[model samples]
Target: MATLGTVTFNNSSATSIFHTSSSLKFSSKPLLLPTRFSPKTPFPLRILRIYALSSNDIKVGTNLEVDGAPWRVLEFLHVKPGKGAAFVRTKMRNYITGNTVEKTFRAGSTIDEANVFKEAKQFTYKDGSQFVFMDLNTFEEIRLNEADVGDKTKWLKEGMDCNLLFWNGKVIDFELPITVQLAVVDVDPGLKGDTVSGGSKPATLDTGAVVNVPLFINIGDQILVDTRTGQYMNRA
Candidate 1:
């Protein structure tokens, strides 16, 4: 009975000591708890941290940070075999260089998540080699270098709305609409016998983008183009 009472007293004493105002108060400084307490003692401070993304959570359009570079998941497949462990196979594109690569990760592995965002901007004009875009809501102007515009320059036209990809608050890349309607600025006249399914002829659009259109297409004709593949869809 005495030993039972002693144990109860000690437990109550510990509770009182741990719950004191000074011990319970939080501070911005490093918090070190009393090691004398039991291994299961509750910590007075809670720390929040950012954990990497799990492979099982991956999906199409997922953004990741690899080797200090930003990548977007173009495609992903979760594969499981009878002989070995499961894994995820992914096709990702680098935001900066516009290069695509295949990557594999263990089923339960973790990957860093990239902080990327997009802003809507309108292509206002080209000042020398720099392309200028304006935020329609804010009217703020942003100029991108020629190299940053890359091959997309061929499809850009004034007043075209675009999505500018930003990482760490800086613009890294941009996306154009999948399809655009452009007028043919130059093309040879179609022969009399030309059919819609017949031979294709090269036609330059007002934006300087050259695409092969049906032989029936003529200068001043409006055509729909797939910006992703640079193919002519049909007359607009």
Candidate 2:
């Protein structure tokens, strides 16, 4: 299969091929490719140029050049707000960091998108200072440092799925699944009549994540948890 711009080829050998084109032909969708931007640049910087823009005007979903990088606009809303200068409320996802950030732009204001890249990888195992992951599609293994994982490392488990963010082909960030279920390895036995008071107790899961479970729950129970909120879900 071959890809050209927004179109992709399903089967080169097959006589019939599907072509998916953008409704707004001029709008450029962001690409998950390596970029060359440093992390020291300030946010809300002006966009100087865009590879997809035909003219000088900025359009939603169009990649903008900012701080010598590219960024994709996930959403954009124009607001008048009854008074003051009109502005655009934009939710942009960093292509390299896989991080979504919100910013307000003055109406008619232009800025560059950071040139970032992303790739889907499967969690393999952890080394001393790095977490290893293998690209399922590419079968290529990559190692990311602890700093790149940030706070998401606590929730990562073996054979989990994760997204690797890259800049200039170097991993800079990653994202983990929002929730994971683990078995309760140990918990204090609940006392009789504890249910009447609506009491809760702390339990340790097999993954070592602590959850507040109902007093009736005992060791060897499985539970679901929301990693994003770090809250307990129903028994698994």
Candidate 3:
């Protein structure tokens, strides 16, 4: 029996050290156990962490390593089955191809986390085949070639802000502003009383991207265009 005046400790190594004395005034309270522990992972376990993750541990806006590339999670939902185990449903976008994927994972499943970094960069002048960008926080210049930028190069403008994505220290992708203001370099003039909402005409922007704008849009007019779809959004 434990003495009433002093605390007795259990020396078992399998348990944690967090405990309360049985002689304390609140002796009726149960002992508290830790929910999780930070233990050193084994070598084999480390290799398994390369591309696996528990369904409950996934979060939106996080990068997951699938196959040889990184994919960014756009949405996630947790589902519980009455007859089976719980699972997670996720909608992820490929950082390399700009494609989307819908995946499901069991409650205890694991997936690898992608090693990705993002930097706020300002677009600079383009060289022979390379586009230059300056890090906004460090002012360091980085030059990426056509292949590194993919189709995103068409969206860049000098001195414009861009979000640069790096996968394992290699330039991979870039995200453009949702809406950009551009002047129409060429467009056919619309007639008076041509206020039809269904009317449309092709207009060429200063950047050379041709878009179908409403009849009212004219040459030299500055308008907002969505970069994702290359569509006119509104007048700037």
Whole-model alpha-carbon lDDT for candidate 3: 0.72
Query: What is the TM-score of each predicted model, taking all chains together?
Result: 0.75, 0.60, 0.67
lDDT string for model 2 (1-236, tens) is 32222222223211211134555232243323322334433222222222222212445665544445546777877788887988877777665566778777777643533345557789999889988898776566788787777667767789998776554435656667777877888889978887676878889887677878888778888777888887877788
lDDT of 1: 0.80
lDDT of 3 by residue, 41-147 (tens): 11011111123455688889888887777999999999998998889999999987889989988886656677576667888889999989887655678888888
Model 1 reaches what TM-score against the true structure?
0.75
User: In model 1, which runs have C-alpha deviations exceeding 4 angstroms?
Assistant: 1-52
- Each prediction's RMSD over C-alphas, in Å, is 15.2, 11.3, 13.2
Pairs that collide in candidate 3 are 51-111, 51-112, 52-110, 52-111, 52-112, 53-110, 53-111
- Predicted structure 2, TM vs. truth: 0.60
lDDT for each residue of candidate 1 in 1-236, tens digit (9 for 90 to 100): 11111111123223322345654644444333322323332211222222367899999999988888999999999999998999999999999888999999999876767767777899999999899998887677889999999999999999999999877446999999999999999999998779746799899999899999999989999999999999999898
Q: What would the TM-score be for candidate 3 when compared with the true structure?
A: 0.67
Each model's lDDT comes to 0.80, 0.63, 0.72
